[model samples]
Target chain A: MSHHIVEFKNVSFCYPDGTQALKDISFRITHGESVGIIGANGAGKSTLLMHLNGYLMPTSGTVNIGDVYLTKKTQQEIRRKVGIVFQNSDDQLFMPTVYEDVAFGPLNLGLDEAAVRERVDFALNLVNGLELKNKPPHHLSCGQKSAVAIASVIAMEPDILAMDEPAANLDPRSRRLLINLLKTFEHSKIIASHDLDLIMDVCRRCIVVRDGAVAADGPVMEILTDKTLLEENHLELPLSLQR
Target chain B: MTFDTQYYNIGFLDQLSYKDTFVHRLDPRVKLVVTLLFLFTVISFSKYEIFALVPFFLYPVLLMTLGEIPFMFILKKVLLVSPFAVFIGIFNPLLDSGQVFIFNGFTISAGWLSFISILIKFTLTVSTALLLIATTSFPGVCHALRRLKLPAIFVSQLLFLYRYLFVLMEETMRIVRARNMRSFGERGKDMRIYVRLAGTLFLRAVERAERIYHAMLSRGFQGDMPTLKHFQIKSGDVFFALSALALLFVFRFFPATEILGRFVQGVFL
Candidate 1:
């Protein structure tokens, strides 16, 4: 039996201002699968990620995570299961101190103080920056802040980690470090990024989104190696990885 | 961008220590209560009541010395913000014309003394406010305000405003820098350009706020933010608050300075 963790069926979303963000999106993410969604700027990658965590209820169809339908009643539970790290680390890390930011998710989950501290330590250790616990988020380097943002979600121990543009605007070394850290997570991952190199390096499954619909979905190597399809969809294969 | 010459960066202040010192360890409710009470007792004296108000200065002095804050820094901030208070209080002398004291055989009206009293009160109150913030962080004050039974929505709004103000302000500063670098002097501050700049900043801020709301909702923020840490009042807090209150009461009610004057007079005569 296949263990499907997230299922979005015929999902369509339109902003309150009448801008359609996602259209008839149907996708199934199985347990422990690493999926990357690649698209242009306005291709609705963020809107889809929001749907996974129940931040946005689909205007048309249904979303399910581990047999539970996404609804107002199941929002808290769904959010606990699906952790989202936003594109901007500054937005994700709002607390005064690093430790507080890491512990924020677990504390919101109503975990005990001891358990929260343990989770915070575990998360900080995962980022390999335990010494930055006392430092403020604004004082951190861009890479460290991004790592702390990931650690903040990781502290909650969510089953699914959905990140948007996890490696955008980073130095090559920082980008390498982020990819290495992301490689260690065993949970089901959904990464939305324009960085085809990082996405191809980590994700085995690739989904191409264009004009608010899924244009193509298949193995990463096959999808990434197709130059004509990429150009047609306003995407270019990275020069280093192209045939 | 030209770097800001202002000494205190709000970003730098946010990262400072939140530990329990002799000051930080105080109960928030007690601190709020005592600060208010101290302000009231200092302000209640008659206009010509300089002698009585002299003893009240000791509270701020003790707070500064014990809290290990710089006295000059607090005084400078108080003095810097004093002109408005002075502007209001100066009218007292012009309105109230009552003669009370004869200094060197020239009668001086009580109105001037009262105006002076206002000046003293303004200095003390403003300094105390600065000292309170200097010693206690903004989050600590918000927690204190929450414990003091202030409106939860307002307190949380204050906390949220402080959290995002830095983020938004930094963004604003960057935009201003970019604009300035591209434009000449008059064009930089032009009305049309200013409106466009502000409009763009507002749009960015709204987008940021929307993202922040979603981020907050995902973390189980159901209208109220729950703080993980709890504050407990200790014996030191009680003793400190009570002793300060008792001292304020005695100073307000008794003519301790008059008695000291009498003793000095007796010694000199």
Candidate 2:
């Protein structure tokens, strides 16, 4: 009863300033598959994540979410199935209060007050953020901000969850909490991060991005432990793996 | 140093707005509409009419007390904005010296009367506006703006500007801190580098705006911004609005201050 799939075919994106960001990249992710997108800095990992929900339309190819192909007209519809939590929680949590931020997506989906409230409560409760609902985004700690940002997207109930560097700003305890929370989500999750250990804990499969292209695609344990492949991509072995 | 203080000052008003008082509980639309009406009525008085504007002070003072906002906080903000009106009105006595009148047996020019009137109006209008935001949350006002049928784009732009102001300030603070740490006494203090920093900040701000737009789009944003706030114009709202308008009408039409003065004269003489 689920068609939760994200497929990119020969997709390429070129910035208007003549910079080619993502070149001929392609991937297919199925329902409930937790995939990690890893790369060195400026290797187009963010650009590739932007393509997942049709935020930046492919300059060359097509992106399909579930049964629908990504198009300008279908973007609003596609956004419902593919929720992308941006890297900076400040950018994502734009509403004044945590409640308003969590309720933003549901309200935009045209749900009535009761339905929006229910979804917001459910989403915030999932992140253990129900107590922080009335506070503004700027008042929250970075980890709390990150949780509320994810809850904002979760309120939409996207079939596929895509997050960019979700653990980039968290302390060890917060990162551990985030990893545990990610493991509990039933949606098909795609996370982009330099935190390889987090990817190792939460993702079953890993795709290595380098030079705006897929450098490797395989199981997480196999790819992450490949020390030579890690060095080639300017990545170090996960600190835990190295020890 | 001044930047840090200004940042906290902005948050102070927001903190005041979130207080759980009756004034804070009032509908923002009611407060917004009433404040605008108060401004118009206060400003509509003739330039030389100073005494009638005194009653308008009751509106803001009442709000301050009911909203649990400190008087000194509002007074400081009102005074901070007083310089512009003071500068403009200072010339009236020199320019319009004709039409002298007697006040407490002393001769004063109509220009002096108008100058004082301007000051009163400035304090009244500015304090009322400050009181409005002090009692009602900014997003509440934006929601009221949307419900009031103002353009959605404009309201959303305003909302985004407010929501992102702190984010932008934090970014700017980090940029400044990075610059300070890397430079000696004057190496990065040159005006040229500051110009370049402004350019870099502009570019970074543009990139951040794009990210925020993408985040909004991903959340099903389609031109119109919706709110989960359900406003009910309860009995308290109508009672507040009607009583306020009635007081404003009486003050605007009648010489309440002059009548009180004469009545006091009758009692004492």
Candidate 3:
């Protein structure tokens, strides 16, 4: 049987304000797949990613990581299974220094100091952010902050990496760096971004969300090249393909 | 100017904390305990005693020089927040009119002596606290607090407060700047405008906090945050603390400055 890293079955979520953020969303990410989630703002891309780690529970359907269903009891394990990098790097990199932020997850898992340090180093090196180890998160440039945020998540060695709008607000050079870095990851990745060029470069498959539901899901080339599907979801073709 | 001053103060201290120096290298717990001890000794002086407090100035002065901190920067920060201490001490001269001593052959009131004492104490305490933050980063202090047996909740609360202070200041500064740009003098300074600004800032802060909490949860954060940098107290730390304690003890009980001054006078005469 092919291993599915993340599986969401008929999942629906409604916020306390009664806003339906996710509606009957169902998807399965196989091991080593790089999938892109694309949607306009408030189309439930982030809300869907939240369910991957049990940060948000599906109001109606089941969410699972591997064979383990997401529940309060399995939350800690599920969190280890799925790592999320939020849109705002500032919100994600909360610890004072870059090293501490990267070690935060593993330490919380009861890892010893040596193990945590090793993981932190490995993660920072993975993102080419080892130089930022001693720098305070707030003092870093936007690009550096995003790099540290990714390192913080990757240090936990999660099975699947889920990032929301990973390319937003990035300069072209940093954005290109991020795309290249994501391409080198061996773990499955689920990225939500409006940067279609980034999606094209990093993701093999794409899923478009609209009105709290999945509008389209297919191979990256097919979904992104379908101008009618892209236009209907309030998204545009990648700049490279626009002409 | 007030907003800018506050913004600059926060950034200035944060930048200064990163400098490499002897004081910054001391274990945070040792620095914390030593600072507290120094504060107690300074504040324990009698209300009318001014001469004895002179020696205690060495603690901050030495820290400033040894730590390579700019003296004028700290002084400016102290003066900026000195109003409350001044307000409290101002009434002392008016309430007590008894004669005390002669200065420059003119009689001085006891009230003046006590008021001066208050001002001295204020400067000593505030400057030391500021220096503590300048030399030791806020997270270092929070870690020290946790290791010192302060409630985990209390330490975490302080950590959260310090972390958000920057975010809050940035948001508030933006709002203030926008108001300044759109309104002329006296137009943007209305109470109603201030009220609305505060309300919006509060709402945005709450939303930002929610986002932060979710981000934290996504990374497997449980109730307590764990730190990787565990501070180990060294021989240098012990030596520093003990020596400061001994020196403070001497400054507290023995009038070394006066004795030294008298010795010099007698020798010269």
Candidate 4:
């Protein structure tokens, strides 16, 4: 059986303003593999993540999840298979309370209230965030907000998790907690972040994109060690790997 | 970070709503109807009828005491927003200077009496509105509106506005703080910088809404926000509504305060 769970088959995307955000991006993510995507600020990392769950349909080409090509008809199932966490916790945690935010996915899936409650509780407990269930998202500290955001997505139990800038704006303790939580997720992950230390700690393989196209794809250590590639892609070796 | 973020109390009323009390436990629809009726009765009084408005205060006072809400907090909040109503009412005494009442050889202008009535109405209406939210959650109010056959779009917009009010205020406060820090006493406080700051805030809000939409789409949101919790009206709700309506009827048609005052004077004499 093929281990691949996500495949980008020459997928290209363009914004409504005629800017080509992704240029025939092709890649495969095997099940349970964690990959780090490194790129410059506007190098299309987020656009690529958006395509995984069919939020933005490709201008050309196809995105397949478990051999099912992404289409309007299959979009529902595709979303269940892949969950994307945006960079900002505020954007993701839109519901009034943490419990409601976590239950949002399951309730939308038409699950019974009891089942939704169970899932929300489970997810919150998994993230050590059960105590935050009734608190409003706005009242939470920055770290708690990020944790609730992740729990909200995790409650859906998606097969693939894609996180954008998972560690940005988080203090050290929260970042460490996030890294440990991500490690516990038993699914394929694509983390696009500028936090090089986070990528090294959680990802074994790395992909570098420059100017809307893939610059390099190799083992994490090999890519981080290569000074020429790191500088070219607006990245650097993680602090742990320095010297 | 002294972000001047004192507006964090935007949800303080919401927190009060979660407390378990007889007022909070009543169905939101019942509370909504009673509050509206109370407001109507209070406003229906004549311009110079201050005695009739005295009895109307019982409804809000009952709610505050039953709901365990602090009277001082409600008073402070009411005072904060009273300036607008006070400004409008202040003109009544100034514009209309006709004598209406005589007490102990002193004459009071009809305009002053009307001005006092305006202040009374303002106190009753604003306090009732605040207490309604304090006892009934915002979602509860939105759910009641939806059940009352209000347009889904209107209720959802209200829900969104209430939910995001905190987020937007915090963001605005942060921007203002940054502006304050970078500029000297009067450097960046001009109207030009204010306009540009507002323009940037507007763009940021648009971008934030787009991201929120994307997040919703990824989670199976299809056109509507579905709520799992359902509301059912119970006998307690019906009883509460009936008693409130009875109070309104008695207070509206009967001069309870004037009769009580006359009885007190007769007994003393």
Candidate 5:
């Protein structure tokens, strides 16, 4: 039996404005599983991922990450465990230099200066971005900035990596580079993206969301092969990948 | 698309990479103390003490030349921002009417010289402040402030504000450009449109701040920013402070400018 790294029990959330974003959603992700979350616009995809990182507390029910219940007290521990890379790299790379941004996480974790530097170098090398250490984020290309953003989070050495639209707004070459980089990570990943090709290629399991609920959850091949079900949920399989 | 082009501008030039020569690397506490002393010494002189004040210009000159900043750039920036100071100082001539030495056969009042003194003091103080920023990056200055035990919250806010200033300003400039491209001159300047434009920018900034907070929190930012490296004071910093104080003493007590002027006069006569 697979041990669950994250388990959401009947989780439901409403925005401060009383807008229902997620309704009684329940899911469990196992350790080392690459799960792709697919949904239409306003289908609660981002809301669900935000919960995994403790960015947003559930209005009802409980969220458990590795046996620790997520509350105000445990939010910090949960954040350290689950690193959520936002869609825009601009939000992630806020420091003056790339090295500083990458080192931010480890330094905050109370690691000594030498240890922070080591983690920063290791994280940058993981993304093949050791060359751009001294450069500021504003000076980097979009693809490079995205990689630096990933490095910034990876420096914390989080147990789970939750990425929202990881391949959004990238050229084919940059997208392929990002996918290749993602393939190198052994940590469990939950990727929410509209790029079905990347989803099918990188994720082992796929969860289709519709109207604040999980429409389908199964293996990537099973979901990708079901064209009717995908179209019904406003997600389409790429023509090349369709069989 | 590359954002590098946007980082190259007057603001970036003034804010970064101007060089931290021996003088620039002195402890900010020392520099701040010495700068205040320089200002007080220059301003405490009598109206007829023009010769004494002339030697004081050396401080700014050395800062410019040694710091590797262009003299003309500092001069231009100082002069451009000098009108208000000039206006305030101009009133001194009218307020105090006392006759002094005549220059070029024209009798100059003591009040005029004092007004001139005020102008010189203004230039020295403002230009030195600008040079301080030009030589030291804003972050370096903030770190110095933090080291001096200023309120941590205030210093941290200043650091955050400085870091985001460029980001927010660039965002604002993009919005202004978009507005300009879409509307004519007067239409672009309409109050209603301007208000809406500013409102949108504010909303965007707030949203950006929220996202930034989340990013910071995710990185284990527990209300404090921990630097990966620490700054240490070297022997050069001590030497730089001592030499600067020594120079200030020499210029204050001895009239070097007048001595040089007399030498030139004797040669000419």
Candidate 6:
């Protein structure tokens, strides 16, 4: 009954070219849960994450965000509740300045300028990106651009946060900063990443996807340590767990 | 320098707009309107009327100084585009044989005079356009367009084009670098490789566009990108616009450059 919960019931999606990206995928993410989705390339992890906010509607079955079902009509409302941070920070931060990019979502929601400004400041402050507000996205370092990308989404103040490969391109230091930043977020978080160590650090639960279906679902540490399961899905144990 | 570094720094004019100065502070709409008027006034004169257009150079010079934009940078950009204008005007002297003028006891063709006029107009208009962007951020200008009641879609397209120009250039730089590294000396930089690379870049751009669209949709983008109207037309905007028009009016009708020339002659002779 929690409004922040996300549930998928037998969801299946096929790309227009007839590639079945997600096959009968069902999962439930309750409030305050942090989950990591792991899979090999082309395993439909991204396609599945795209469903949370209805960026891609399930060709069959249903996705529920909080109290309402996700449909063409409810996607806009669902988007306000479920914020998505894409893998490429460049694609997400498209506006002229960091300030305008962070304000984009709130402005799209028809918020007034004062309200948008407040949200932008709060979100940028949360990610320590306030000083970068005037800089163009291109001018930002990869780490700064990623932080602003997160701020752009979180400015909507969504209940659930989903990110695709949030730490993929960061340096070790920037990756550490990202982990620390992610730890401060109390929203229900779903992350799809190849970084099992990041998953172990930030997410308590782990979902392993293979061939567009759930291969394993368990606690992060348990799944990350299962050498056979990880190997079967073309993954390896977290570096910390290798020895 | 490397290709990408050069490609990256080309947008330095855009960076210059972020600097705080008198020209940068004016409302973008005011600058845009006045610049259009200046361009129109410069091109309206007869092709032989070089003296009037000579004074028009002051506008870009004033803007460059006030905006703190590097004079040489704008001049370099102006020169970069000079070949196109030069090509178009080059045939004038050869085709119009009878038009001639006697200047300082040397016979000068009227075609030469007209070509010079074209060159002047070209410099004035192109440099002013560059200065306008150098002073006003592109988004500021796009917002001005929206405020002026231009189609919202057109403005949004311009905004995206400006923002993605760097993104596209970076993508091209990567592909070029990859090709360079793979090719031993200068092999892959050929036309055939370039044509194939263009196709690859186009496909990649299309994919990136899809992802960008998905990102926009996830953030509740309806159809149009709604820009917040925060630009207030302050008194300085009006004063700037009015004084610019007054100056343009005076220089347009009066040969200010010739008068200055005569004044210098009277003093120095």
Please state the interface RMSD for every predicted structure, separated by commas. Answer: 1.5, 0.9, 1.1, 1.1, 1.3, 0.9
| Clashing residue pairs for model 5 | none
Better of 1 and 5 by lDDT: 1
Residue by residue across B1-269, what tens digits does model 4's lDDT show?
A: 43343474556777898899989999888889888888888888888889889988888899999999999989988998999888888888778888775678788778888889999999999999999999998878887888888887887788778778788887898789889899999988999999999998999999999999899989998766666657788998998998988889988899888788999999999
Residue-wise lDDT of candidate 5 within B1-269, one digit each (tens)?
13335445456554444355765676666666666677777777775466677777888888788878887877777887899888887877787788776667778777788778778778888887776767766666766777778777887788777667777878878887787789986766788888998899999999999999988888888776666546666787777778878887888888788788899999999
lDDT of 3: 0.89
- Which one is best on DockQ? 2
Candidate 3 lDDT over residue span A80-169, tens digit each: 888899999989988878888898899888899889989999999988999999987778899999999999999999888999989888
DockQ category of candidate 3: medium
Ranking, DockQ, top scorer first: 2, 6, 3, 5, 4, 1
DockQ of the candidate models in sequence: 0.60, 0.85, 0.74, 0.66, 0.72, 0.81
Position A231, candidate 6: lDDT:
93
- Candidate 6: tens digits of C-alpha lDDT, residues A96-206: 889989988999988888899899999999999999988888888999999999999999999999999999889999899999989989999999999999999999999
Model 1 chain A is weakest, by summed lDDT over 10 consecutive residues, at: A1-10
CA lDDT, every prediction? Answer: 0.83, 0.90, 0.89, 0.87, 0.82, 0.90
Please state the CAPRI-style docking class of candidate 6.
high
lDDT by residue for model 1 over A99-157, one digit each (tens)?
87787788888889999999999999998879999876767888898888889899889
Evaluate residue A83 in candidate 3 and report its C-alpha lDDT on the 0 to 100 scale.
Answer: 88
Clashes of each: 0, 0, 0, 0, 0, 1
lDDT for predicted candidate 1 compared with the true structure: 0.83
Off by over 4 Å in 4: A1-4, B1-6, B94-107, B232-239
For candidate 5, write residues A127-213 as lDDT tens digits: 889999977676788899899999999999998999999888778898999999899888899999989889888999999888888
Instruction: Give the distance in Å from residue B144's predicted Cα in candidate 5 to where it truly belongs.
Output: 1.8
Which lDDT value does model 1 have at A169? Answer: 63
